[model samples]
Target: MNDLPFLQHFIVLPVLLPLLAGALLIPVKQSRYSLKFACSVTSTILLWVLAAVLLAMADGGYWPDGIGVYLASNWAAPFGIALLVDRLTALMLLLTATIALAVLVFSARRWDRVGIQFHTLFQFLLMGLNGAFLTNDLFNLFVFFEVMLAASYGLVLHGYNLHRIRAGMQYIAINLVASFMFLIGVALIYAASGTLNLTDLGARVALLGNEDTWLLSIGVCVLGLAFLTKGAMWPLGFWLPGTYASASAPVAAMLVLMTKVGVYAVLRVWLAVFGNDAGALAGFGFTALTIGGMATLFFGAIGMLASQDGGRMAGYGAIISSGTLLAVIGQAGGPVLASGLYYLLGSTLAMAAFMLLVELTERIRPPGAALIAITMEAFAIEDKPEDPVGQGIPGTLAFLGLSFAACALVISGMPPLSGFVAKFSLFHALLEVSPTEGKVPGLTWGFIALVIVGGLAAIIALMRLGVRIFWASGDIAPPRLQFSEAAPVTALVALCVMLTLQAGTVFDYLDRTVAGLAQVTTYSERVLGEPPVMRSPQRGLER
Candidate 1:
């Protein structure tokens, strides 16, 4: 381990770098917008680089157990705070950094200038995201969750537009409730298990008596609800579309990962603390998760079809991705879970790019034309000659149209894109499990149907929107494209394409990640410095 003492320190940098950067930018005057922008861009790029290195180090070839634990102040687990850098955590950090960097680059054009302290809030958001992904204790997770949410509150309302403020209020209200529930759940878990360290909690869970088990189960349910709310699972996610649509393009893009953080928390806590070894607690909320995920999928699909606004459609797409991941995870199959991870990555990139592309496309269209056209189409009215005509640079229309089409294909999971590969991989994984072996459950068919039908719904919605904006109406002008704005979208889409090109390598890494998640013994030994104790047979629990 001492062979790379520096890597141990790298684990904390994802949190510390952003924290310090955000704090330092707070005192900078508005006149130094250039300085703030430069600092934010540099910090995000460096964070992405650092995350990439950490991910590489944590890969199974370098760290076969897939854990790189860091104890602050040289402390040990279950007593002091720990920063665990497993493959999953490292992957999340990398994803966060990648999206942050792209969003920051996209924001540099003008969005950052619309509001003061934008850079500071953005950095704080990164700090919170990194902290949440890295923290090993439940209380610290709450702390980081709050940090992320607080920064998001500012970002959602950054421009202070009337619509943004209205949506931000609703977003803030919902998340506050979720936070309260999270606190209550954490308190209950700590009360029942006498610990909040995840690995320690896992070790202790199997040994809990009937009463403690009952309390812990309640705590787990409450915690899952909190996470599901943040994940935008159906009923709890009503605020997501409005909130995302109201934010600035880059801010909306960064907000894509916020839902994923909730999903990550559920996956981490469920598998680590209440996995198969938790006896009666085993598969505690699988039924709820599976059903809720399907419901979320159905809701998002319908929402996407109903959405006239591009940003809102992207929001629904995110919800659909979250639902897909949640349902796959609930199934508890290795190959399917791995495919879900891939799907999560692809969908997030595509959604972020879509959010950015929405603004660019909207810039080229005549103001109010989209809404008017949608209304007219809904009412089956003919277009009037007096309708506004869009005007702009010659090639801008084609560029915007192509970018919009690419985003549409991606969001709709169409062919020759990363989205298609991701969905195909997921479907393939699900089908690979033999019905003869009884691994194919009833929910499997439901999940498969949702995945297929949701994609079809997205395709229809996007095509309709695209045709109205690009071809059906003559109210579009060429949009003015800047390198700062255009490059990020291009880069994001390119990254997705890269994922498709390198699907084999990416799937291999995901397979290793899934294997690492199943290594309960290795994880327990690493975190606790000893093997986990088995429950007594008289306790009516089995591993």
Candidate 2:
């Protein structure tokens, strides 16, 4: 598949198809929503299939360094916009498409009615997400970032109320500042190195002398802050719980993938320009990434324990997932990064599924039962017997209970799920350090402890949510759940189960991904073309 010349053309389809679909959707009347829905869904399904093919192409070795590039114009790097796809990029595309499909199906029942042009915005969001994963330059990355954020601004406020309005405003304000910082950082990097192309920047950054090193460092740090803000790191992330809590269920699920996008940016850019070739500039900012990851995890743990609502708790779970990935990236080793990648997949699916389930389970709970359940669990009250769960249970009750349990198992890293496998792999990777290496750092211990405590906190919070939704709510009749609503949640949870069953295969794939990302020189060379690189002299030093 990788050797097929004709298949290389499909690299541009992921971006182009969604873009064309979104443009077409704009003219359809709201009265013609069925047409809009059909177009949106069919495009997404085709996207999911296309992404699966690309994932296979990359894994089968599409090009040197396992990266396939599509030049938007005939011009080469630092001139024309370039889109590069590798195993990691392909993995994200598939993940984004999966979640988008589920969210679209889940929203079909009612939330689509909240506003005009909902499907239009949804397709554009997919376009932005696919473009972000595929782009190979900083400036193009920013353009896609704005596209995604712009679509989200509308989606977040779809069913406008006072709460949604306030949350959406905060989301908009923070991202605008982040966008400003991203632009400034790009300007600084270009001014120092004479290019905005990622591969060009990578090559030039390595050649930079002491004169431009500090400026490059400052620019990279500024970029990191913007991405960290998007990833929901501590101090900058206090708005996440409220934003997710107030969002409609499917929108919140989309936000779940959005959080991971920030983490993905940090992972790609940091390692690319700062890899082994960067000379004294190598390994810059990793310490800060570690410390920040710990702080974010600690903050998430406290927030999880304190949360009473399911939406808010799921928000904190995303914070914890981001924190874990950031910390693993800070470790900067193949084994640990492989583990973290698997963890990212499982936690993302589980959290998104849980967010969807929250809307349905709320149907069964009394208005104040979460608080009451918390009090009862804290005090160990004995009045409530276990609800009969296994046999003769109403089908609706049974479905919600099992789905919620699967989510808890995955999020909390409990036995018999992919979450457990992820954490165990992490622990093993941390312990399996080569004999040539020094004693384990305290930061490693700190990360281990944080993972443990974070998992415990999730267990408590989600367990309490379970008690409230299923046990304390007593004998309420099942709320009406549409097939569209139930199927999406079922599909997502089932994916986690599949991950657990196929853990070995998934881990091998992730390991190859980690290995591919380490080839920084190859990445730069392939994107820049086969000739000897024309050096970019340092700019603005004389000015």
Candidate 3:
């Protein structure tokens, strides 16, 4: 085994480096070169840490130790702070890091235009993201969440506009409430289980029978609500669209990764501490997940239709996609697992591209506008009369159209796209559920609705917005697209293309990832006993 000291360094560096860099950036904010170099270096180092940790995991031959390295004091877990990395956590960490780097690069010009402080917030936000992914304790999770939220508050209001301030406040307030509930839920879980180490909680949960089950169930339900709110599930995600729409492009891109953290936590907590515990809580099962997922889908689709702004519409569509992924998890068996993970990958890539598009189109004038607004100080031109002969359609509009089309293909689950691959696995998994297994009735109908409505909503919404924004007779002119902005969006689209071209390879990787999920006993075995034998193949599958 690798030395514990080395692992501790790996576990802590990703979080600490960003915080240190962010603190250092505050003093040098006046230097543009320093700000740019600092953000780039911080992001690169974090990515390197992510790669190093994954490499270490591989070298160790996939250590399933539920509790990873402890703190400087080397205190025992549940009593001392520690970091944990499992397959799900690792996946999310890499996802956050990759997206973080992309967003930082996308924001280079915006940082130069606005202020260097945005990078400061971005780095701090990343610190929080990394902390959240790595922490083994629930309370630590809440702390990291607050760190992220604090950073987000500044970033959301970076432009210091009326709409942004209002949106940012609402977002912050809503999350604050969720944060409180999150802490309360953690306390309740700790009280009921007498430990906060997630791995230990799983073990304790397996020991608990029907005696204190009601309390356990309620605790899980409360925790689930907090996570769902973060995940942007229906009813609780009311603030997501408005806030995301109002935020700057780079900020919006980073925000998208936050929801995935919530989802990852939900999945981990659900499987670990409350796996199929029928006696624990009422209304806290796959059935609830299915119901919630469906509700989120309906609400998101409606919200998307109601939206006039393309950014807000895309935000709602993101919520809709999240709901679908969660719902598939509820129907978990085989294909559902495959679909949920695969769909997430697809959506992450697409959302990054769409966020860039939204930024590019936010300022373009109509077909007859005579000049461009150079900065917030130039906003007086909002009332300027257009030179009817001089204005022409903005090239940025064409870029938006292309981006929206790409998003449509992914979100709608069109063929030869990552989204399609994800949905196909999920729908097939649902269909493959044996009727004899006593599954809920009309499951297939639910899956059918998911594919049909999700596809239609994505397509119709994209078409409507594209036509109004890009081709309508009175549509606004597109904004200027800089190389910095265009490059990231193009690279993201290229990733989508690569995903499409290498569909088989992507699916295979997804299968491996899901397979990692299947080996839940691996963690427990490392802690308590020999690992359980996994069946080589399912009886339901034919040769």
For residues 118-226, write the lDDT of model 2, one tens digit per residue: 8989988888888888998888999999999999999988877667788889999999999999999888888788888887887888688787888888888888888
How would you encode candidate 1's per-residue C-alpha lDDT over 219-271 as one tens digit per residue? 98898889989999989889899988888888899889999999999988888
Choose the strongest candidate by lDDT.
2
Cα displacement (Å) at residue 5, model 3: 6.9
Candidate 2 segments whose C-alpha is farther than 4 A from its true place = 1-4, 367-394, 434-438, 530-543
**Residue-pair clashes per candidate:** 0, 0, 5
Worst 10 residues of 3 by lDDT: 381-390
Local accuracy of candidate 3 as per-residue lDDT tens digits, 1-543: 333424535657778888887887777645566455656556655665665576457334555442344342455555667676655566667777777767766665444346447667778898898888888778888889899889988888776556667788999898988888888888877777787776677767756666555566777778788899999998899999988887777788777788777777777676666554323431257777877888888888888777877679878878887787677767656556766887787788888788777756545535343233235335532221121232233565666667678877887788767777767766676666735567645855775696678677777887787776566646464455556667678777777878778878767666666675555556554433422223355543111
Write down the TM-score for model 2: 0.92
Whole-model lDDT per candidate: 0.84, 0.86, 0.70
Looking at model 2, residue 165 earns an lDDT score of 80
Root-mean-square deviation of candidate 2: 7.6
Query: Which 10 residues in a row give candidate 1 its minimum summed lDDT?
Result: 381-390
RMSD of each: 7.5, 7.6, 7.9
TM-score of 1: 0.92
lDDT of 3: 0.70
